[model samples]
Every structure is written in C-alpha cells, then in structure tokens.
Target: MRYFLTLYILAIVTLIGVAGFRGDISRKPPIEVFPDMDRQMKLRPQEPNAVFGNERSSQPYVEGTIFRGMPYQDTPINTGRISGTTNWVETNPIELTVERMKRGQQRYNIHCLPCHGASGDGKGITSKYGMVAVANFHDARLVSMTDGEIFNTITHGKNLMGSYGANINIEDRWAVIGYVRALQRSRLATLDEVPEAMKAALEKE
Candidate 1:
C-alpha cells in the first residue's frame, strides 16, 4: 500500500508540473507578431478591372484595322458597285420553262417562301412578327431589277434583311433569283403568251 501511495503522489506531481509548464507557455507572448502598417504604405496588388463597365478608363484598339480571316475591314464603307471580276457571269435569264421554274419554285418554297410568302407578296410568317418588313418581289421596283442586282441582294441582304451568303451558296442564290422572276412572270403572264401545247400539257398533268 505504501509503494502504491508513493506512485500515486509521483503521478500527481508529474501532472501538476506539466499543467504549470503549459500555463507558463500560454501566458508568454506568441512567437509570430504582426505590425499594423499605414494604409498608403501598404503594398497591395491592384485587381484587374471588368471588361464591360467603366468604359472611360478602358483601353481602345486602333480603328480601320482588318483582322485576319474576316472578309470585311473596319475602314470607311463606300456603298458602290462591286469592282473587278466576279463568279457571277452575265447570262441571259433562264427560259421560264416548267422544269426550270419548278426547280426555282422548290428552292424558294423551302428557303424563302416561309419568310416571303408563296406568292412573293412579303406576307411571310416571319415578316408578320418581324420588326422589319420584307420586300415584295412581285412589286414593280423589284420585278424591274436586273438578275445580277437580285442575285447580289440575295447574297448580301439589303436594308433590314440579314445576309443569306452563309446559309445559301452562290449557285442556289441565283436559282432562287430565277424562281423569283418566274413567280413575277406567273402573276403577269398573259393568256396569249401561254402556248397552246403548254396549256394542254398542264391540263393533262
């Protein structure tokens, strides 16, 4: 019993010594101490500004420069006749034959009719809800336009129309122009101009 009592007293003294050491260390100042500096003298890296807001302080790029791979330049635009040779060769308008007209009609119906109406009357579904009005190809102004002019308009849209250059290829644009002319002709074609044989063939079909 005396031996066990001595062991307990030693254990109690060791725990008290450990606790006293911990308390002494806790009362002492921390090893790391930070000094408060003046706001102006503080060295802080500035953050990058957002791209959109505060335009006045933003940097501007040079104007009239052309980026590689783009067709257009930022230079002053001169709306004039296109100079130099073009793939658009001048040819007599295709004959208003049924087969040729049918091809044009098919192309127009698929790509154009939804926005320009089946009659080319500019009453297409998109036009009805669209902010800008679509042109009526049947109008005298458009009907009198040359085939090349019509083709250009289709390739690079005029006024409020967006360009179809990407959507429809050059050949298809010409075909659609031919079809527009055919539609105009159909609206104004006289009875005398309609051949007797064509009338008979159409009736049989």
Candidate 2:
C-alpha cells in the first residue's frame, strides 16, 4: 500500500511538471484529463443529428410569441396601424419635438447613414460596394409617401433593405423616421420655406 501511494504521488507530480514546462509553441488542443461540462448533450447551430424527423436543431418560434420587450399594446404607435387596416397613419404617432428629432438624428447616423447618405441622396459610403440602389429621400415618389408608409418601410424594409425592427426599438425607430423626414426637407426646402432673415442673408451672399 505504501509503495502504491508513492507511485500515485509521483505520477501526479509528473503530470503537473509536464503541464507547467514550456514547449515549442504550436496550434494544438491541450490534453484534458477532465473536461467537465465542456461537451454537453445539446445541439449546436446547424449541427446535424437524427433526433427529430427534420434533423434540424433550430426550431421555429412557438405560435403567439410576441417579441417586444414590453407586453403587447394594440395601437398604431406600436403596430404602426389600426389593427386590421392596411392604410398607414398619415402622420407620425409620436409627438414632434426637438429632443425626439435629435434622438432620431443620432440613431439615423448610426444605422441609416451606412446605406442612405447623410443628405438622404442615396450616396452613402457603402453604396460603392455592389449593393442595390438605395432610394433618395428627395425623390418625388418617396417624398409623396405617407409618414406611416415610410415608418413601415423602416420597420419591415423595402427592396435591397433589411428590416431594422429588431435592431431599433419602437420609439427610436420613430425618431429615425422623423430625422429622415428632416433630411428630406433640408434638401427640398423651398426659398419660401426659409426664414425671412436667413433668406435675406443668403440673397446678400
């Protein structure tokens, strides 16, 4: 028993020494005596298994699962419409305030500016890549689109655009919409729309 105990201790010491000693650096998985819970009885993404008939690990969401953080609020502000109607809300449901517009401008710069140019001219930096045409906000057709339609487009996305609904929260999305409208106005603002004082200054220049 004494001899066996001595041998066991020596074996443990040897293992510790081997682990601590430096060797030639190479890309290799280290030896694991006990990888506790490292390998679990769970399916990874896209991992094939014969468990289900479909053999897919990823499952669809169960029915009636609302994704928003807050509980379902059946309103045009949250759903962007009057429950069953396809008609869009003519104007933004959120109050048009300077603070909200500022927030919208910040969110737009972070998300929309990559595809829609700062001036909403469809000349964003990413446009140089092989992407489909981005719509210019100043275009008469887009300008004519109702505010709710524009909000729906941002929430669900249009051609060549992906939905931002998941990425941006509901209120921020509205803010972004407001900022987009502001951009359109900046480019399409008529001389009559300018303040008299600003117009006079521009005329002098």
Rate residue 104 of model 1 by lDDT.
71
Q: Give candidate 2's error at residue 121 in angstroms.
A: 0.9
Predicted candidate 2 versus true structure: per-residue lDDT over 110-168, tens digit per residue: 99998888988888988889654898888999888888887788888987799998889
Model 2 error, position 4 (Å): 58
**Per-candidate TM vs. native?**
0.49, 0.63
* Cα lDDT for residue 27, candidate 2: 66
lDDT (CA) per prediction: 0.66, 0.83
Clashing pairs in 1: none
Name the regions of candidate 2 deviating beyond 4 angstroms: 1-72
Give model 2's TM-score versus the native structure.
0.63
Candidate 1 to truth, TM: 0.49
Per-residue C-alpha lDDT of model 1 across residues 93-182, encoded as one tens digit per residue: 444556756777787898888788999998888876764478888899977776766766666788887677677765566667778877
CA lDDT of 91 in candidate 2? 76
Residue 40 shift from truth in candidate 2, angstroms: 9.2
